[model samples]
Target: MLTRIVRMAFQPEKVADFLAIFRDSEDKIRNMPGCRHLELWQDADQPTVYCTHSRWDSAADLDNYRRSALFGQVWPATKALFAAPPLAFSVYPAGVESSLSSLPASQ
Candidate 1:
């Protein structure tokens, strides 16, 4: 399994718009092939900062989704609202660890 997180900072006033985009697309994204999970999180101390957490069966699957029309449409819209380029990275688990508590195993 692969875990991915994207950290984004948006114009404070664009929070609602950003959230609405996520709300409208979360289910579709979660249902995509090889997608195991999807979630949106906002920084408690900095509400304009947000992060997206997701799990994919493989990096290929994630790449495929990124090239798909869904992403083509969604990403540009989302990117336009960002205050800066998003920070994203991937990780692989080494057995069970407390740091991974927030992630569930792929079903």
Candidate 2:
């Protein structure tokens, strides 16, 4: 499984517009093939900053969605509202095993 995260900082005045776009497209995005989950989050300290977290079966599935007509429509509109260039990346679980005993003791 792959997890994709995109953080967007929008103009203060454009936040509403971005929300409306997300509202209109969220379902379509969530329903796309290989999409397992979708969520939207706002930064606690930065009201105009938002992030999208989504899970996909694999990177190819994500790339397919990125090339779809839905993305074509949604991204440009979303991009136009950004206060800064968006940050996006994909990752998977490290599958590392660990225990509290491995940690340094607190003073």
Candidate 3:
């Protein structure tokens, strides 16, 4: 499985707007093909910061979603509210031994 995480820092006044967009689109995104799980998270120490945790069947499934019309609509609106560029990455669970070699080399 492919797990994806995206951390975003939004403009203070735009937090509500971002939530609304997520609320409107969450179900559609979760129902997309190969979507195994989806969640939204807010930082405890940073009110303006939020993250999305999602699981997909494969990297290609995630990529397909990235290119979909739903993403086209949601991403632009979401990024417009960002106070900083978002941080996004994907990984496999640590328990998955095969994924170990795919991790980036330590600095």
User: Of the pair 1 and 2, which is ahead by TM-score?
Assistant: 2
Q: What TM-score, over all chains together, does every model reach?
A: 0.86, 0.89, 0.89
TM-score of 2: 0.89
Residue pairs of candidate 1 with colliding backbone atoms = none
User: What tens-digit string does per-residue lDDT give for candidate 3 at 30-102?
Assistant: 9999999999999999989999999999999999999999999999999999999999999976766667777
> How well is each residue in 1-107 modelled by candidate 1, as lDDT tens digits?
99999999999888889898899989989988999999998899988999999999999999999998899878988998999889999997766675677697879
Off by over 4 Å in 3: 96-107
Span of ten consecutive residues with least summed lDDT in model 2: 94-103
**lDDT to native, each model:** 0.91, 0.96, 0.97
Q: Which sequence of candidate numbers ranks them by lDDT, best first?
A: 3, 2, 1
Span of 10 residues, lowest total lDDT, candidate 3: 93-102
Candidate 1: clashing residue pairs, number:
0
Clashing pairs in 2: none
Off by over 4 Å in 1: 95-107
